[model samples]
Target: MPIQTSANSRLRQSVGSPFLASLVSFLVGVSTLLVATLLIDAHLPDLSLASGQPGWLLTGGFLGVVVLTGNIFLFPRLGSVQTVVLPITGQVLMGLLIDNFGWFDSPESPLSVARIFGALLLILGVLGVIGFLDALVRRTPVVGNSSDAGPQLWLWRIAGIIFGMCSASQTAINGRLGVVLDSAVAAALISFAVGVATLLLIILATRTPWQLKRIDDGPNPWWMWVGGFLGAAFVFGTAFLAPIIGTGLTVMVILLGMMAGSLAIDQFGLLGAYKKRATPIQLLGLALMVAGVAAIRLF
Candidate 1:
């Protein structure tokens, strides 16, 4: 979460266009994975293994692009906390459904009372964290000025949740791909490769430029360029972890880390993310999110 947030922040700070930032991030991520693939002499054989496999498995890359570009567009408008939390809430919910139905050939973990309770808690957490409840109680719009940005802000928040659902699906697909190829790293590489190809098509179709706009007054920091590397680590980790831990547990752990990291980023304004100190209600919301995940996966 931190890595993704940091990278999004940098792109928002330095890159003018969300489409361009998505392209750059994927390019860097793919390049890094390519080097690793060559160094390890990994047995990718994605083409040979492509036949007979469910077509949906390869869609991870497409979903990944959706998430990357969506996050880029969402971060500034929603702020760091909402950008991270909203999608994760969606991720958890979608992950539950994925596990229950064995979507994408993932292992089946049917929903139970505990799981439903967890989902409810997660929804409550989202409402609290996004200040929806507070606004409702106060009889005000969540974003203030219902006549103007209020509706737009709600729209972005909804998009963030949908993007998160894409993220959960991506994780499941990539995990299954990793198992098929017998190499998590190779799966990540293939995912990125497809993402790059998809992004190129989008850029061409939209006529988006390769040049990034300079948002910072001074020269860009070196760390900003490395967000993709961190993203690679995350993709590889989730791909590797999901099959072993089950999608529910995998999403739970990732969400826990993301919530904690996003809070720190919001409070400290790390990675050029907007600074907004978490309120007590927001902290309580975080606690609820943790409990919700625990109920889903642990209890």
Candidate 2:
């Protein structure tokens, strides 16, 4: 996951516009999947399966843009800790909702007292993992400016939460799409295709320039182009896993692994990330999250 994000970071740098960069990466990914599907003689997706309910598939692409754009806008304003942590809170909460209600034809993992406790612990763990708790203790902004003062800042924070909810809901919707299409890969590909179409419309509507000529800077590394493949893999994994594991568990496990990778990235300065050794509090946070997951799973 960190590798995927690092690739996205490099791609963002290579392409001046984040939206354009995402569109290009997703295009490469979907094209690759289409070719691979043909090569494998895999069952091509039945477009008819999507006839009655196109909105489910559209959620994946549309909400993805919301998240990408949300992160781009919120990170600077809310500080990295709040930006990352807040969305995670929303993801887990919304994921729990989906799981409890069995929304999107997903398996139900109804809420329980133990699960609620585990969730609270998980949120706290995330706060600690990102150093938000520590920063709050010191009365300092959490790892960025975070000084965007006003009622509007709260609005952006709420937007951040909504973006998080969008992510969790996207996973559930794509899972249902996968089931309907009878192919997780196909669902992921379709999701990426929709995202591409959506981005194109936004570009046209906003009068955003293509800026393709900027590639003249020089040939970008091959790894930078791998974002699309990584993205495809991620979407496919979530679509495949959500139905089997339940949305809440799926999101929890993903978050656990994501933060773990993030800590490694920070500690080792991997993928051009800033070098920062993991603090004891962060390690403790990871432990608490592990415990939280255990609590959720065991009960």
Candidate 3:
């Protein structure tokens, strides 16, 4: 009886550890990203009065490298869901603030009703995808059960919302910053640096020893990294493109791309995670997300 009890305890602990790790990773990732943004913002030159600022471009490039490295380390711990969800949520919320308050740029920028509705629809679609994925996991015993439940799932859902907001906020940041830095490569570099610095700081504070043993030990799927690079490009590109394309349009298109990319990534089980094949419901949800984007673009 004692042995059975010990085994059960260990089982529960093992199940719980990854979830805890995911949460920690999510927090660290977001915090680091924000810090990187701050770093970029601080180093930005005033290009309003002057035409071009070459130095700011250099700084932005450096930052982009930092952000990319940070993701390389952080994503594994957070898992794909939390890693993607948190930032999406952040983008949605921050995007609204930046658009309405114009905190990062001219205060004259105003929020529109269409954009708000579009954001809502986007959130609903994302939730639908999450629910669909959760259901798939539950139905497939082969994949095993997800540790997420009750409040924990909600927390992750909220994290997704934050991630959305982060995406939007980044659009604003990039738009404003572009005026000074004026180059996508520069902005990407700066964002990367911020990402790296934040992760390094958190690792140091947590006193977590860096482990490289799992690096090459996991799946050798090179395609997964391609998705990551695409994601990185989308993120950095959106920031650079937002100024020309407008935040609403940029986000809508990027979200469309992300939904499609995520489906492909999740379907293949590319990241050494569960393999829950996408179902009709998920496809429907993806369509809805695309529709939401279209609505925003047209209206």
Candidate 4:
């Protein structure tokens, strides 16, 4: 009886171990990412303007794949909602920090009232879209298994928030980096390197199963590269323009571009996920976000 009880205890601990580790990893990953953005900004202040040199943009794309792939593995285990929400929240906070402190390149950038309002509108729009989607999903008969539905539905909502926050942060950080790195490719490479290095350390320390074999399957998917490239371009472009047009204004423009791209990506379900039809509510949300952005720019 004693031996049996001990075995059962071990089994319970083993089951819980991954969950605990994943949570720790997620927090650490986010912290590292925030630090990395600052470091990249400081490390390559002139990366955007490098001329007469071979561009390293492709390398950056490769690194993006590595970073995202790592996320894919880590997210599911770490509660998809948390995986999405916490990062997004972190990004927003970081953006505010960067803007207020002039951490990277925006020394004169101040977090104005208009910018705060814009950010809030943007957050609301995202939440509205997510809520609408959850409603739609619940209405589907095919997805009506209560037991399976409850957790997943909540998870998706959480994921959406996280994704939104992360997107915002990505915009701010990349934009700041863009100021220093002239070529989008170079910025991608440097950021990718940081992401890859961070993940690699995690893998080494935790003995996580990272599959490099996945990269050799075929010519890499264009969409996978798109996120990184677009991200890089946005960052570079934003940085270039942020100084001339305040940080808030720069993000406003980028958000518009992101909305367009994200809509297309979600509508088609291009990455093997179910196609997400954009409803009226989503359009309304987008409009509100855009309007808020525009207002920030004008006021």
Identify the leading candidate in terms of lDDT. Answer: 2
Q: What TM-score would every model get versus the actual structure?
A: 0.83, 0.91, 0.58, 0.53
> In each prediction, how many residue pairs overlap at the backbone (N, C-alpha, C within less than 3 A)?
0, 0, 43, 14
Error of 1 at 51 (Å): 2.5
lDDT, candidate 3, 145-223, per-residue tens: 2465678656655644544554465565655565556554445545545445555565566666433123335533333
Window of ten residues with lowest summed lDDT in model 2: 208-217
Return the lDDT, model 1, position 271.
71
lDDT of 1 at 38: 72
- TM-score of candidate 1 on Cα atoms, chains taken together: 0.83
Question: Which of 3 and 4 is ahead in TM-score?
Answer: 3
Best by TM-score: 2
Candidate 3: which stretches are off by over 4 Å?
A: 1-90, 106-110, 132-167, 214-232, 268-275
Indicate whether candidate 2 or candidate 3 has the larger TM-score: 2
Q: Over all chains combined, what TM-score does candidate 2 have?
A: 0.91
lDDT of 1 by residue, 167-227 (tens): 9999999999988888788889889888889988988999875665555467777777787
Worst 10 residues of 1 by lDDT: 141-150
Q: List the candidate numbers ranked by TM-score, top first.
A: 2, 1, 3, 4
